[model samples]
Target: MTQLTDTHLYREIHEQPAVLRRLLDKEEATAAALADLIHGRAIDHVVIAARGTSDNAGRYAQYVLGAMNGLSVGLAAPSLFSIYHRPPRFGNALVLGISQSGQSPDIVGVLAEARRQGALTAVLTNRPASPLADQGDVVIDLQAGEERAVAATKTYTAELAAIALISAALSDSAEQRQALAAMPDAVAATLSMNDAIAAAAPRYRYMSRCVVAGRGYNYATAFETALKLKEMTYTIVEPYSSADFLHGPLAMIETGFPVMIIAPAGVMAAEMAEFAHAVRGRQAEVIAISDAAEVLATARVPLRLPAPVPEWLSPITAIVPGQLLAMHLAHARDYDIDAPRGIHKVTETV
Candidate 1:
């Protein structure tokens, strides 16, 4: 077995708490300044352009910015700007580009087009000097330091923190800021359960296919978890919102089929718990990632979140266990985790 500390992915996973703290300490003012700029504009909606793990962070933004700030949020299809010559009008919209490396030409193209149309543009990236940053009216650095792992761990959470900081700043809520301030400790508490998650991962070593479900803000968590599982364990993992799972996909759940549920204690908790119960009634093997006892009780292998977090902020902490699960599961399956096959640390799509 590979020592957990020896892998860049593992080390980056453990670096999340400090990374988040650094973001909060350094970028709160930047986020607030961006919020002030937005407030001065007639920005009516938000369009976020990202890919892969960064796209998952944009999923979280759809919920946070939409729910907290009462603005419509949409994910931008970069192909409209890059592959096709036509880019949509960005009138009265705030277009944001999110990338860890800030090197994807397509993502930069979206921001560049948005800027050309005189729309407000912002960037969330670890690389301040990258081309994606060059086009932004405001650049909020992720401040996660150097993330060497091809599978993003610290940078993903840092992106989430940057988004949440902007949301909190836009709302101008002291309560929300207080919650943001506490997030690093919450993430640290979640990380302390690393041993438990590593132990539980081997049980799913032989599992080849599964569904990961979450609702609301954690819909992103489900997708991000599935991405990690695919990247590291080479498992066929599908992510779904718990609502969508029941719409039709639930038919695939047979006896002993694995379904991972992300059901934290929040407004979506009851619905997600009900979803878990329904999956259990189908006799599927439930692997739950949750803080709620009702949800965890249903899991054959429960990966519990030790700390309580606002559902909006839950995805940031929830993904830690998912990342750890992927890392340890890959170890159990004897796959090279530090360097996943067929993928590089920085993927630039045009």
Candidate 2:
């Protein structure tokens, strides 16, 4: 059985705060350039193309851009362009491609097609020289440096911060900018919980399967956390929106089953509290990651956030403890935290 080590994955998780700070300090000019480029075009809508962890970031973008910026954002289906050879009309749209490596053929193809179709194309990637960078009219480097771990840690949060910065730049809102600026500190604060999260990992060491749930902005965190557990610990974790869980998935809960909930404070707080009550009635173990007192009260074991973050900004800070949970769970289960079976840093998919 493998024990915990100073793995690259662990290092990358701790490096997130520095990665975010580097992105803001060094990439300010690049973000400004993107703002200018976006302003020059008449963007009537938004379409983001990504896969895996980047796709989770895109999901957050869809919510933030639509709710805060008043622009309808859609997640692009690259298969439509790559496989069917039928590219949607993206004219007068802001088409953004997000990738950690910037090497996905389908993602790059979609952005290239969007650019040819007269849409304003932009790219967010850690690699500046990758193919996707060339496809975009404006490329914003993630500045997360090199991510050596197969299950992305720093790169994922960097994408979230990059999206937030882009949104702030687009709106020229001082409040939004301030929120984005404070995120690094928030993440740094959350990292201090590594000892606590690691101490609690033994409780779920034998967890073979579970459900991860969240809503509103933190819904993306639910998906990403489930993905991390799957990738690292080989856990069969299913993620759902709390509202959607009540539809059918709720029936899966049994007495002693585990249900991990990301319940940050905001508009979704009350609904999450209600879900917690329902889970309690089922006799399932509700492990909640939240800053809300109500949510903490309902959880069997609560991993509280370091600060009370608003829903819009919660994704950035809320994800840290979950990421740590995945790492600690992997270590507890005696799995290699740096490299999972049958996965790589860059997944090539068409």
Candidate 3:
């Protein structure tokens, strides 16, 4: 039985598929215009600046831009300009500032300076009229209206859609767009598993800490899911790429410690399956989000994807179940689903 208690986060999560479709239908022209600017200026490098949830979106942007356009992508350290007052050369770069509220002082500071340094600056924000949007040479609205929840469900997916749209436009690949067209349907199917995920919540009700792992394009999913768990459930969660996990963090797993793995069917699936088997060998609880039968079989608790989604577009769909797990786990533990401690809708840091 699905929990009947209604929360802002729960409502927003259900609203994502509609919001994503609207973005695809409406943002086609805007995405093309941004692509034109990229080509016209001959951007050689890409730099993205964001904070909190938006930074996770920026991480997805890094992977998409690198894989699709073959451009060098780097995440900006806002403190370099906001705190130290040092400006690096970005004359031939495309700098993107991502903020859901478009009100973050430091993110705007980085974009303002990037523009001053002769870089082509763009912003992906829900607010088109905000100061951060004003800093953009071009502004791509997320089209996620008035997100009432503090934890950010619709807005985060909106950011991923916007970034994926930009990447597809830059490449001018109809095949990529065709692949992306499957996302809304995939997301819808994922939402149908909410009841199942909620039922599985008790398995992690006592979970105090965990590791979220992924690789390649879904690496950002790992980071974002861990962020959601920490923010809403107050769990001490660490996120890592599968390779990074092997380096040192693998030692942290004790007997029966919860380990959440996002291993969608992709080139990285086999590698992730191997890691999952190894974790199970350590007696840690393996909670896997995957569509691969082999990976699913290796897990103690399986939260399956609806279909075999393409690797390039997996992050947008794969993260939905993770978000549901975090929300359900928090609710199961009696935490406030709408408001977590010491956090606000818009975080302003300088």
Candidate 4:
């Protein structure tokens, strides 16, 4: 059966890039504005609002900003903050809202409330001309170009780029900036593996069922990869952490089950490798994917990233693999690669 190429999901994934040219170029503006906003405002606290992958991006930024600069950065669900939770004190606060499309009603509401209470606002989105952008004091577009797929790809990476820049700007550290420059090259290296993934797709697509496992930061990568597989290949995919997989999720494992472990060779290597051993003992096929080479000879799918930088920086590098897997699997299954089932480029929920 030949794969159809007209679906929105197809085009989006096919064209998905590690370094979206325009979005990459726009980082300076976003960073400059963010820095100016915080540098001048005598900032009191920081709040980030996002949903889906953007939420993960927000969480990454929150962790980076707070740890790197001692800034009080926190993550909040847009709907919960506006509809249920009280707004944080705003006079000295900065509100950072992230969404691929700047039109979600919940996001719009949260940003509006933050502004109404005196918080300075910034919106990071692909659509700069969106309604939510209308509400922002500054609009930092991802410049990911037209993403036709319902599941985000370039936009997500672009969001990270935008946030990475913003985080770097808020702190007075050159190390952060140096790390950012190295990231794009690492992303490029990851992209080079796409062809390798394409060659491996037939093996993945025929598998009866598969499990993707990870720990700490890579857990998000694991879950997102599972979602891509489910959305693209209609595969019976489950994502579990290394620790939790042994408890309950592992019981379902037997001879035929294939396990893909995302152990990115940083903080969680020891524990992840141990989980791999347990999975192997169960007589299940284990495929260990890592930034370092620690898995047993027969189980290794080593992803050689640009040396395990900081843990915070590791997630950005790992995203490249998830995108590759999703695209290739979808292509192998002959499913629509661009517009997936029941996905909107921009989700506007109240």
Per lDDT, the best of the predicted structures is: 1
Q: What is the TM-score of each candidate against the true structure?
A: 0.98, 0.97, 0.98, 0.84
Candidate 4 has an lDDT of 0.73
Model 4: residues with Cα > 4 Å off, grouped in runs: 1-21, 39-45, 71-73, 81-92, 206-209, 241-248, 296-311
Worst 10 residues of 1 by lDDT: 1-10
lDDT, residue 117, model 1: 91
- Local accuracy of candidate 3 as per-residue lDDT tens digits, 98-153: 99999989999999998788789999999999999999998988888899778988
lDDT against the true structure, each candidate: 0.91, 0.89, 0.89, 0.73
TM-score of 1: 0.98
Model 2, C-alpha of 47: deviation from truth (Å): 0.7
Candidate with more favorable, higher TM-score: 1 or 4 = 1
Our tally of clashes for model 2 stands at: 0
lDDT of 2 at 250: 84
lDDT of 1 by residue, 1-350 (tens): 77777988888888888998899999999999999988999577999999999999999999999999998999999999899888988889999999999999999999999988999999999999999999999999999999887888899999999999999999999999999899999988998988898888888889989999999999999999999999999999999998888999989999999999988889888888889899999999998889898888888888778999888888888888899899999999989888899999988888
For 194-312, candidate 2 gives per-residue lDDT tens digits of 99999988899998999999988888999999999999999899999999999988899899999999988898888898999998899999999988899989998898898776689
List model 4 lDDT by residue over 133-183, tens digit each.
987898887877777677787777777777777777777458887877776
To one decimal, what is the Cα RMSD in angstroms of model 4 from the true structure? 3.3
